[model samples]
Target: MKLKKGINIIDQHDKFGFYCNGKFGGNFVAETARKPIEDLSKLFEKLRRSKKFLKKRDFYFKHYLGGETPFFKLNNLTKYLGGAQIWCKDVSAINGDAHKAYHATVNALICKESGKKFIAGDTGAGMFGKNLALAAKEMKLSAKIFMGTKDISRQAPNVKFMREAGAEVVPVDSGSKTLVDAVSECMRHYVSNCDTTHLAVGSAIGANIFLKICAWSTSQISRELKRQLIKEFGEIPKLKLINVIGGGSSALGFWNEFIDYDKKHVELIGVEAKYAAPLATNAKVAILHGAAQYCLTDKEGQIAETHSLSAGLDYPGSSPLHGLLKDTKRARYTLASDKEALNAFKLVSKLENLRPSLEPAHAWSECIRIAPKLKKSDVIVVNNCGKGYKDKKIYIENIGYYPE
Candidate 1:
């Protein structure tokens, strides 16, 4: 099927790519970067005018970003925490059970339109793989997912979800046996199968074009946060937006809307696992997973091994934008230990009846630690990126059983 004009699926150029330290990294075809609607403002306008586009948009809205996720002040949990008005953006409430659902749906739509019959990619905790697999099923495309053996074990539920969604999950047993290795393997697969397959990267740390696409697609979170805050507070409140940085997609999405605003009024905090705190400790610029960025490495410059209770946070590198943010001080980078994250997980479940996946639990850990030091009137928004159902087994084995 010939695609519409202005949409080039196979072209690769730096037209919409990102630069780091004045060097070009990678690029993506413009067609896949912007899907469904060409212009942001014309989304509703287009939906109103075109029944075909509206049907497609409604498919995504109903199956992916239904906009029903809760965005409200966690009054009970906030009072229990004792300082700051804590608000939670419940991304887990999305269709595929995580924020990755948005990007997965967008990429799948692109693949379907590009006339690709096969889709391939890698995942950290399997959420992206699961979501992508579901999208492939809906679009009648074959999916191949590469996941670290370690992640396969820790995120078994998500692996099962992927398989059930008709995806083939391949385990990578290479260096560190984690997300980075899976990324390498997926890229190799994409290189060999480029004609019939498309690699839908799950993170913001990949090729420059993909980073832009994922960040742009997920930026809806920031847009909604702005609107919700205004409605709840009668104006936008001074907020310290906190998100756990795996490949930095959530942070990039959460901060995209606020980028042009005054930096002092809104603070962005990116929390990484203490076991893999490269952004906070040694954010030296390096290349990994096709993009140049700050990565965790050894003296010999080999990618270093990292450990985290959350498989999603076990990556050894971060997105280039995150590195730039660290250098520019636009966002503060911090670390949360496994103990702290687990404690926050238990606290949120007990106090608010919400079970956050270990990934965003890192952000919750940081918020709990810092909320007391801030003014009572200050607002703190935590990007609760994923639900905790997938972590039940790991949580039971590592942290022991929790009472109902």
Candidate 2:
């Protein structure tokens, strides 16, 4: 497929990051972002260890959601790999049964705290939308979820959950009818509706401020991970953190607490779905969906359409934070084709007796490739980013079965 029917260029020297109101160097908010960018930027700063907000978030995530998520070993897979010890940071048990719950709750609470009655957001595989809708309900706010029509079909369970929670789901039929388009629709709505609606970005992508908000919500994961790691191994071991990166909420979160450690000691690996692998494919640095980051763009600089078996990973752009990491060589990215991810899903489900969403399946695909090469002293942690129950149709169609 000739993307946009133009020459395909690989941009290896591109810088990955964005500026907000001269906050980070070059404030480059898009026209659609003018209204809320400043406020959201301020909100990001205000949320830094603020007692009231942190207390509220803790109540919501702990007593309301569940307690801390479990980080445990995959004994069967570890033994099967026969080299590195493999483990799972299971975010699937989050309140919304996905990592998006963290961002959804945080941003939605931000909305309520700001006295906004409505939350506007977007989703790909529908998990974000579902979680945002649930957050809106809990916070006594209304929600509008923009999702591609194609995603609405594949992610019916989440769509149903969103509507049942009283969120309005708008289906974008244009473009690829996927995540990027849904993101565009949501942001465009923000331009006109910022007064009463807070843009609750459900992942660590999109506009710079939104990215900060999402990343902040997920930082708790890595903090908990640190404690779990110490408890599990008696100390932090030579480890690799591998996770599937769509918008990168989970991957970034999985690594956040450990980022201060030396890369030689704690390696970070990101697995992107093949066609949607901007980091792996060497995408150009461009402003897409309001953030300057590695984007799969046509010659005209317009976002190119991307595809993946996993709806959550289907996007033309990636998180700007990921771009900066790539530029600095702190984190490396790899690609997992749909076939490999599906096969990984089958392998893990049968061996480990766990059902993984397709996104994490991509990480498992990478683990399968590299696990045998590492020494037994090295530990590999793959993030289980979402609940597999939402992928019932995907499992039935691709793998012939969906675990009960």
Candidate 3:
């Protein structure tokens, strides 16, 4: 389990830890930050094994991130489809209107506990950056956010929120200048500054420690979903959960709780942007973001550039957790093009009177596509992981109109 120092971070990425071995992820932490980060992993594992029902995260979810979100049955969408029952896991009410806060807040708390003065991390659509900033502020810790320049422009709303919350937003100009670059720079920055910083990875991704921590924190979603399902129907109904796949945090969180159930009982489906799909495309295994995973690679086997109208989903690879799920056939991955997402965004806005962020709109689009094929007793819950407020500009720009 001994890992050598990660090297040539700005160039060669394979020196980061391999995904399979019991090694530190990314091998990316500095000597100073290593113990603290390792302590964090231990802390999360301890709480996870506690019999207190994960009460700490539960408290944060309610008060800090806006209590247990609703599992509202989409009456209009269901009636419109006329096949399966559709439900919306409304995460829009959470802080930053996304599930990023689920892990960000807890990570900031852990930073404070570790006596760190700052929490540093990266963002894609900017929700994670904003959430990290807000969490640090609430914990009275300094925050630094790294975001790719491309994301800064399209996700201005969250960028503004991050700055307004008193966090320094560093624009990454490297590589594609999008999420992948932001993650690289953030982890690199942590290497030099880990004396007082804990890397706050936003999604269920990155090196093994990061992937485990983020996924563990976001698992709060499915925890709530499981409880809400019983309360809603007085028993768990035939269910299929659909969530957008970026780094696969939210989707993993949404699906993990139900994963133990029989596939014939609670099915899980993950939706990815058509052009950015790694798992959905059944991509070949490769290294990305310091770990082994599936990615869309070019003919030369380098990770391919990905395209998605949703800034959050505009990445070439997903978490190894997803790769395992896909390979095991426990979860299914599918694609939805930008046009289909745009259409679903507008259509659902009109039908449900709910404005969905483009990220989750992809998930909704997949739900819209498959609901018509299921039986009437089947229940479909789509993770509306973000609100549309942050996407108003992008939405209007693409469709020339945003629904009122």
Candidate 4:
């Protein structure tokens, strides 16, 4: 692919060095960079004037991207939990059943602008794959999704959705037969098909350039949350923003605007599955999936096998910015075991009539742990990142009954 003007060229080694006006700009990192849109007024003005922006905005609106999702005040659940005004940002209401729909839409837009004909990537629970397939289909581009065999089994519904959306699903059996292996297979595929295909990374975990793009795309979540909070509470209310972290895109999206908000006003909590809690356990930094980050590894630095009831959270490494947040104490990292998550899943479904994917159920477990101790005046906002439809069969098999 020919390099576009003002866009940096990313080599096969994944070294991202930006160049603008014939001068080398330093490598991009989340901590040092400003938020995506510093001035909303200027951004709106530019969007209004640019034909390309207008076209993309039309596409986004048609597909329900860049729009407000359901923000519910969970009064009954809050009463049951006995503390905090609990609010849930229901990303599951989005078209692809997850926040990843926004990511995939933005990725497709980028590829369309670049004149790419094919979009391909790796997925865990298949949420990203389904989203990508939907976007690619809408854009008249072909899609190929690499998924782990284990994830394919657990996420059968999502796999079927991807195929229905015109994506070719390829099962990967390398490594631990999970996300890491899927990523490896996708990278190899990209190497062979780089000219015609654009890799649509599912998370904020990749080369620096890819991470920057993901963070910028997912910033819509925080922007919408801020607007909704003001409308609901008469102002941006002080609250605890709770999210589950696999590759950290959802957590980053939820907390992006609040990163510079008063730390005392907003406490960011990122929960991980107990079996894949690298950040919670302070694991060593290592290179995985083209980025150096906290990874669960053995004595020889090989990626360790991870298990989680939620296929989405069963990853060996996390986004690099998450490690920075943990190191700087900007965000607190915690873990919830399968038992705790499943119990919260059942409790939330019964009390709230919301069947959240097990990924965000980990965040709900953390909320269950901490909400009771907090004052009633306090607020907690949970990102219900995805719906539980794909995991229903797995849940029934594990618990031996349907959740009432």
The prediction achieving the highest lDDT against the true structure is 2
List the global CA lDDT of all models: 0.79, 0.83, 0.82, 0.79
TM-score per candidate, chains pooled: 0.88, 0.93, 0.90, 0.87
The regions of model 2 sitting more than 4 angstroms off are 1-27, 30-32
Error of 1 at 117 (Å): 0.8
Candidate 1 segments exceeding 4 Å error: 1-16, 23-59
| Most TM-score-accurate candidate | 2
Candidate 1 positional error at 41, Å: 21
- The regions of model 3 sitting more than 4 angstroms off are 1-37, 47-55
Worst 10 residues of 3 by lDDT: 3-12
Pairs in steric clash, model 2: none
Tens digits of per-residue lDDT for model 3, 1-404: 21123321111123343433422135434476566566766766665667563676677778878788877898999999888999998987676688888888878867876778988998999988999999999989999999999999999999999999999999999878899889889988887877767889888777666787787777778888889999999988999999999988898778767776777898889999999899888788777766667888998888788888888998898887777677667788999999999999988998996899999999999999999999999999999999898899988989999877
- CA shift of 342, model 3, Å: 0.4
Q: Tens digit of lDDT per residue, candidate 1, span 33-64?
A: 33421232133233335678546745785655
The weakest ten consecutive residues by lDDT in model 1 span 1-10
Native-to-model Cα distance after best TM-score fit, residue 275 in candidate 3, in Å: 1.3
